[model samples]
Target: MTRCRLCGSTALTSVVDLGATPPCESFLAEDQLDLPEPAYPLHLRVCADCWLAQLPPLIAPEETFREYAYFSSYSTSWVEHARTFVEGAVERLGLGADAFVVEVASNDGYLLRHVVDRGIRCLGVEPSVNVGAVAREAGVPTLTAFLSPETGAAVRGEHGPADLVVANNVYAHIPDVTGFTRGLRALVADDGWVSVEVQHLLTLIEENQYDTIYHEHFQYYTVASAARALASGGLTLVDVELLPTHGGSLRLWARPEGAAGEPTARVAEVLDREKAAGLQELSGYTEFSARVAKVRRDLLRFLVEAAERGETVVGYGAPGKGNTLLNHCGIRPDLLAYTVDRNPYKHGRYTPGTRIPILPPERIAADRPDYVLVLPWNLRTELVEQLSFVHEWGGRLVFPIPELSIVEVTS
Candidate 1:
């Protein structure tokens, strides 16, 4: 943390300090609940030199990813998003049966399963053994290993160079940006395309999405910083697309420097937007800490008032972002009661640090709480439709991000 992870500079400015919290995904089992739990610093800082917003690499990737609790297939919209991305990639890249696609950190083969259906050869390089096994079970060929320079070279040597390397929602997970980018270079063909999707820092700041900040996410990237990260491994960003997934994200298209032509005008357009939003300067981040504080205050006010009024408030979705929100707000089982999730893996566990019990999705309907706090607010539209039945018992849904609002659902 002394020097920027992306750039070796000491000029780092504080973006926001979220105090300390356990790894968002570290759900505790009932047996381990009595034991002491550990928490790490959740502060995010921006490098004045490179402008990459980052946290210190307090936890290693293996600690989080080796036996990950998150399964991408649980989210209906995310699965569809992956399917759409695969179809578009096939058409956009002119990929056919001969084409080879490799996805890094390919959790549960969410995206590559579509590639498999199309008869395009694909492989998922995933670190988590449990989730990778699920991918293999689904008939998506997966290799259980972390993406390093050697790992990428080995994959390339065994299966030949990849025609397309898709890395979605993982660019920010790795602590060593330079080494991870080089691993990407080693896997992709010289002229092949590399697509990376990461949460956009501009939207994160503007939308008051501080809950997304956690130890698992080592860094946050704007287009300017992302382009620099891509260049470190000799990849040139050729195009950029703004995506709605994960609140707001950037879909960056890159390739080897030799094959990468001039970047699309969209790249410049987003860069201009980032500059306007003060992401490249200090002004944009100045009010962020205050705004984040306001969110924490507003949420706490609602929860405490609801408790006083004898109204039950429970949470929905035990996502990593939800853990961050819960821990940062200092919410325990008393305020939240319990949260329900679609993922069976988290059904009987407790959220890290906050110790909120995670029950099955059906628990929400069985108990019929007064208010269901939607933690994974990024999937707002999809979750709204899924939880529409809440209107049955006059139950309402709550969204915390982009400001706290309680929605009256019409079934």
Candidate 2:
């Protein structure tokens, strides 16, 4: 058995078993659909010593992010979230034209674009060449490389330390978070701050977010686990904020050691909340597998009933999480006729494992699917409003996780 990634403990416990699944973001083009694809086990386990839920590193980073399909600017609410965060950070950090900013995994310069517009010197370190090209085109200086201690040192030597290092939804994608956080410390100025956003593990267990589990996301973190990783990287937590994005995420602020960051009360408050909710205990994760199993059964039952009634069912998004859910639940194109997306890149392609046909959102109105499973349930409000025309035929919205729920929509 493999030891825990954060702490080398042989005492690893299973949390949720997602079975074998393909790379969630690896959408197949029409020409590539006939090719054989690889799959990996998607089970999650928690360390008895550190309580960090994790998956083994079967897929290398090079294959996962070389030319990624995910583009941050595609989501409206997400773009708004990034803009609001930049505004807040600029105000709180007192950033100006002289301040230098660095963003790790900065996809398409969605947030750094705001910083550049403010005249603050900004740079982005992106691993995906395809995504980095888009950022470079947007006038955001981007380096097509992964963040590491060596890479961090090189950037610091040439460009000097940064006042702010932004990491949003990138930590989970990384296998060596200890090394990644160390790179964040190596690149930031002595008095500068490192802000990281990760999907909260508490939300995963509570909201039945099994869909979020994939090979790319190697680790799941609670505040306790995250603080441990950051501390290992020579940083100290100063503040933590809960976000509604990505089901629920935690935005943690940290500073270099001996810099006197004086953590906010929210730090202890959230820790206490996690302890109160049993997140700090191994037993808390034991019941989660059963909770996730219930969801799989329920979703399968819903799809089967819909098909038996001679109703059409389709999906709304092609997010990585959606692929995990569909593959885990054994959903096929037979039950779900096809899925639609607003991103033209995903059009004319098929989901990784489920192989559900991908089409434009216009297909939803033309076919008028009786049930539209909102694949990205976290963005249900935005998708529902955008797809309000579905109400013309009394089309219903389905949320499979957090207990299968059917919602009625009005135009």
Candidate 3:
């Protein structure tokens, strides 16, 4: 029996099936055109015991993130987001020369750059070789290995326990959830705080964000489920904040039980809201699958209509979520033409399942396609501003999630 990753519950129900799909960032080369892509079961399940939403087991972390393709510094908005997060966290924690900060899965030192700038000692534990090299170039000392109980203990032995341990958007990606949390407990000092940012399950269902379900994201979290998971490893949630990044996310602050800091009203309020919404009930899982089906049908119909009208459609932002959405919808190059990405690594490669070629953003301006499908719909505002010149050709930007809407630009 496949037990729940969090609560060890054997009672689980399937929620949504995204079918077999390649890892979102598994871009292909021209020589690899004929190679069969490795597709895994993209099924989500809810733990009846703890109510944690999660994907079925598939690719291991070593296979998925050992040579990560994503670079956090590619997006201008994301860079600003990291900067703001660092500034706020440092101020909130009163971190200075005496404090040491450790960040897990710190891709390219995006957030740690600010910590180092403040003259505070910081260490980054990143598994991806290429990304860790970038972090090293940025002057952030990064260890190239997965963060687990053993690695965490080694880190603590060398650098001592951290005052602040930041793990932004890494909680959902870990498959061995129990071992990972235990690693956090081993690394965090008695009074230190471990802050984790994860895409909120409540927001994922409410916003119809099924595209976030790829092989790398092993677990989806609600504040209640997160608290339960942490408590199992001897930690307690002290505070929680709802963030707007990646559609919607939650920043959870945790520490050892009875160490310091009391659970904030926000934590209790969020947990209460999740319980009232039936997150812990089986009915919630059944309803979520139906909602996802509606989204698939709606998106397909919109793309078909556009194709019939001879509207030149192209995709913006070759993000992982975009890959999942396109692959699930069975969209290919005939409909999307090509996708634009700011990351150099993704450029000149083809998206996994669809095989849509990825090019630089300049292609959009040059081609001036009639319809630009904004794949990374979460960055609509920033993308619209950057590609506003498409208005010169009377082109419109199409957003295809939650609903399909075309926004016309007025110059």
Ordered by TM-score, highest first, the candidates read: 1, 2, 3
lDDT of each: 0.95, 0.91, 0.88
Count residue pairs with overlapping backbones in model 1: 0
Candidate 3 residues 1-411, lDDT tens each? 289987788988888888989998889988898998888889898888888888877788898788988999888898899889889888998988989999999999988988899999999999999999999999998999898889889999999999999999899999888899988988899889999999999888888889988888999999988988888777899999999988999999999887846789998899887877778788666787777788778878877888899988888888899999998889998788998988889888999989999999899889989988898988877888887888999999988776777899766
User: What lDDT is reached at residue 69 by model 3?
Assistant: 88
For model 1, residues 173-285, the per-residue Cα lDDT tens digits are 99999999999999999999999999999999999999999998999999999999999988999999999998999999999999999999999999999999998888879
Alpha-carbon error at 393 in model 2, in Å? Answer: 1.4
> Quick one: best TM-score, which candidate?
1
How do these models rank on lDDT, best leading? 1, 2, 3
Best by lDDT: 1
| Residue 149 displacement in candidate 2 (angstroms) | 0.7
TM-score of 2: 0.98
Candidate 2 Cα misplacement greater than 4 A, ranges: none
